[model samples]
Target: MQVSAGQAKLGADQITEAERGLLDFVTIEDGLGPQSSRRHEPDERTDQVRGRLDAVLIASRVAPLTRHIGLVPTVVATHTEPFHISKAIATLDYVSAGRAGLRVRISARPDEAAHFGRRTIRRTDAPDGGQPITELFDEAADYVEVVRRLWDSWEDDAEIRDAATGRFIDRDKLHYIDFEGRFFSVKGPSITPRPPQGQPLVTALAHQTVPYRLVARQADIGYVTPHDADQARAIVAEIRAEQQAAGRAGEPLHVFGDLVVLLDDSEAAARARLDRLDTLAGEPYNSDTRVFTGTAEQLADLLEELATGGLTGFRLRPAVTGHDLPRVTGDLVPELQRRRRFRTAYDATTLRGLLGLTRPANRYATTAA
Candidate 1:
């Protein structure tokens, strides 16, 4: 489930009920967007809203309130340091008791770069001195690698807490990850202890070869947008091939389709609702994912059909949070259960276990072994 902070009324108390058994993971998008100029800022007279809430902070705030649902927040790799992100996510896992995951993202927008002013990103279409889009994906892969290393920097049993001897931690259990990369270098034995899940779940949305490669090499789960079963099959095959080439052929990697849904009791009603929303915005709503306007039954049917093409699950984007979210939780969930396609209850505590992924061994530990 994808929730937009700008649109959703996800107050702290409201989240507990909203995240009941219906959702295994609640995903929050990185809401960074173009900042408003003083002239362009909305006055009280206009209802337009602009500023975005940080994704990771929002997840952290809600982690204590919800227990079973995994809190996955988007972390942009473009200008952010991997070490800081690693510690923050590790802390989230501790707060949530291992129900934490990260949606790794990369920013290509020039306006986003201006906010940082640390590095200038070249436009993808620019002819000269511009960084290639491939480089961005490569850098993102490196970013995830460093973060994963930091998560494993302190072994699981590093903390001994031997008060009699006044020994707080086992120094021999701490390992330094000497990572040197083209984009950045990290020398680590993370200040944070190993997270509960060892390495918190890493996910990415891939729409092309470069990003698919990144997901294949790094992500535990990959979100893909496909229009039909054939497209889904092709994307899955490509990702599998890439995974095999990366020497992770036997690893468990989930491929989930991304869908935007506007559901009602009937198709016409759903269409009319979307039409009304488009009119209010003064344009048609366009999205990279397939947009479905139909009944909950129809949406469930589509998901099941797409699953045949090897998609393990879906990340649904509601057209309107207040209206569509309930439909997903109350209506669509039962519809999926009726078909015996969805889980009746959360069987696992950790996000990795919820997704049927085993906790990966610490890379440094395996190296030492």
Candidate 2:
């Protein structure tokens, strides 16, 4: 939200404070072009901040400013090249010293599609139904696949920089990744070598079976919106089934609940704040995800309850970033720590390490046994 208001420094300050608060990670969602509507089409409402800063660039800018906290920026896969994304994120990994990850998303808005002019997206490609939506998600899956393969195209030991031997790189370590899919085709090695973590974390937000399959097939983390614990449990179960069907049940995947929160010192104050915001915006607070209005302790209690439903963690969207983000980092985090439910110190340095994900082996590597 700070970035939306063109306050880049404030946004960086918030993230640094979040790191000091010991939060695991922060995701900067991009609105390359946006509509405030749920469909993501253009809307006439001008009350909200409509300006968008590129998510990756913002993360890269903030990389050297903070340490330990993971920087996960949103990148829309639609109309984007997998090779470019792979290079950008790989560079981000280097800039952040291995604390970078990305949440890959797909844009269906005709307005957003108009930006690249690569292809026209009809309104029929809506999120509700049709083969078009499935095709988009499938393409997104392929995009992730290509990005992953390209990350491994240059093996871990490809860069030798051996000036003594006049050899800067091991050419034999580079491998061609010939990937052909229904949506895209790419040949040869990526210009960027394997990232520090081998592969940075891949994530997506899944609401149904199609997107769930994408999450199962590729994502290291799946963000889900569930209104209640029962729904959370069911969603987790469904994603787990999809994982098994995708033949990736053996791999560890974290399912994180997504919530929109308006936090305060008291539950009443929180509700009042939400009501005020809604009144100013001239619309009731509405969202696809659950809305939480409560004290930090209450929010923490809710989180603990939801975690029992199989959610490994949560991604809370602050209704007002300036207010609620501070509440989350200062108040809610301490309450969780007091309950001995949260970490008082960062447990790991890298984003993958923080998430308990082991660094993946570069598939193209042929090391001696």
Candidate 3:
């Protein structure tokens, strides 16, 4: 029942402050432009601007400023090289002392292709002779799997010091993951040592089978959108089945239901607020899943109901970030704690701890016979 703030166009400090309160996780959007829309303006320069206000810089600042908040910055695996991201997340873990997570994003838009001078990758349905977009998504899953392996190429105790013998590291503790996939090839051992958390955290959104496979086999957390409680249970069950098939049933793979929330003290007031916002925007905002428009208490109950159906948590999208995030952190969190559903104070310092997850073993560590 812990809350988190998804990416919003707010100052870094305000965002960090909100997480410091009762919110346990903070996801910072990195390098994502507006979704593909025919009428959207040309964003040739937006990419540069995004790189300027880099998510890593924001995370570094947020990590030190807040004690127990989980700082997860998005890393686009398609356009950005894994080498850079590995170092960045490792550095973030060092600075944050293991409070780092990553929202693994794959570039799905064709316009984004221009930024890298790569051909516009099309989804499965495109007329271009390219492989189906679905297949590309599968490739993306492979890409993240490779990144995960690279993150674990070095054991937690790989770095050793023996000034007397002039030895600085135990080479046996270092591993080569030499991973090659249909989309990319990566040679072993990460430039940086294993992150402070061993492997920090990797998460992704799964709207289809491709991502579901990735989430089942790779991610520590998976963000999923389901229509109702029944659908939520079904999705969770399917992912659990997939995990068993992939030999990852022993790992704690959290599935959080994704929702867009508009809260008020009364149900009528919340509905009116959502209606007014949609009217202000001059269009009906039809989301992929149902929107929760009610009091925080009512929303909390719905979350609990959904939880019973198998979801471990919820990722709320505020109708308007500036307006609703404060309510979520200030209002909803207290209500949940009052019910003894959410944590009152952080019981642990690390992000993994906040989530009730242990620091995982280094993947390179294998028992010798």
Candidate 4:
């Protein structure tokens, strides 16, 4: 995942370069504020990411310049309106010719909640505390619910751009999605028509049980942080259990391990590179995802080992985007290709197609029939 701010042309250029490497997809990470190491507050730390561009808009800007790779942008579900996001991502799917997806994220911080004055997210420490873990996760689930419902509100072929007849659309094909949940309610047929991909791919990143349940219920792919193969296995097992519990055992859910990588020609060199970076930054860089400093071969070995633990794929975050992103596209991808783990050529045009997901039938269409 990459977040490039400032200019759409610059972001488009970066994405175009990534696409040339035949990578399956690229994610645009979006944030409401400067994301800090501190989960809740904005920081004065200069080393951290201080700014980011709108992920969906960046994906849209790059859409026309590239082909084959998936463009998935993260959207904060907590504060944003689901109705608007559904239409936005649906438009992205059309603009990208079905190579579009979205990553749903929650903003639970008071600082973040302040951006939207309509609600206040009280801290657990506060006298009248705000959202509990369950409340926040449940709200996110409802957000996804509304988005998915709106995606299915209009049946495929609802638009009839007829010249001979005076018809613009088949009104019967559009259905109201009257969704009333604890957090919010939506009345739809989205303003935008059904996307090219019936329901554009919905993805989320999960660390614990609540989020795991969200992944099982709503997401096509769940990005998980697991340090080792055993941990990966445990996470996958728990998510699988959740999926079954949610009565979605028969549906496909891809669990991808997220890792930060600093790769070089050799392990020693990679370590040295990271050491230099940490030295420059004045502290050792650490995150929820383990930072693997090694060659592409070693990374491949790690991925293969992790896959055995039921992780279908891995989402490697480059330690330094400009430096490590190229190694991933140039070095790591080819290594996987040689082992038959990665595709050599572009096999599918649409993001869902590449992932082997069949275009789902509209729920409204089926209900009407």
TM-score of each: 0.92, 0.94, 0.89, 0.94
Q: Candidate 3: list runs displaced more than 4 Å.
A: 32-52, 125-127, 161-167, 366-369
Give me the runs in candidate 4 sitting further than 4 Å from their true place: 1-10, 46-49, 122-127, 366-369
- Model 3 accuracy (lDDT, Cα): 0.78
Model 4 Cα shift for residue 163 (angstroms): 1.9
List, residue by residue over 1-369, the lDDT tens digit for candidate 4: 111111112366567767776776777888777777777887788765577778899889889888887888999988899999999999999999999899998887777778777466754545575666567778999999999999999899899989899898999999899998898878887999999999899988899998999999999999999989899999999999999999999998888888888889999999999889889888888777888999999988988888888998777777777778778888888888898888777888888888888899898885535
- Candidate 1 per-residue lDDT, tens place, 33-138, comes to 6333232222343445565688788889999888788888889898899999999999999999999999998887666667778656674647776567678899
Candidate 4 backbone collisions, by pair: 122-130
Per-residue lDDT tens digits of candidate 3, residues 1-369?
Answer: 756667545456656666656676777776645532232234444322333366777888777676777888888777777767887898899899988989887775666767678756666685766446676556667777777777798887788888999998899888888887787788878878888787788888887666787789878889888878898988998999988988999989999888888888788998898889778657787876568888889888888888887998877877777777777877888889889988877788888888888987776697779
Ranking by lDDT: 2, 4, 1, 3
lDDT of 1: 0.82
- Of the two candidates 2 and 3, the one with more favorable TM-score, higher being better, is 2
Tens-digit per-residue lDDT, 95-191, candidate 2: 9999988999888777767787766664456675433756888899999999999999998888999889999889999888999889888996899
Q: Identify the runs in model 2 with alpha carbons over 4 angstroms from their true place.
A: 1-10, 122-131
**Which scores higher on lDDT, 1 or 4?**
4
Sorted on TM-score, best first, the list reads 4, 2, 1, 3
Candidate 2 TM-score, C-alpha based: 0.94
- Where is the poorest 10-residue window by lDDT in model 4? 1-10
Off by over 4 Å in 1: 1-14, 35-47, 125-127, 366-369
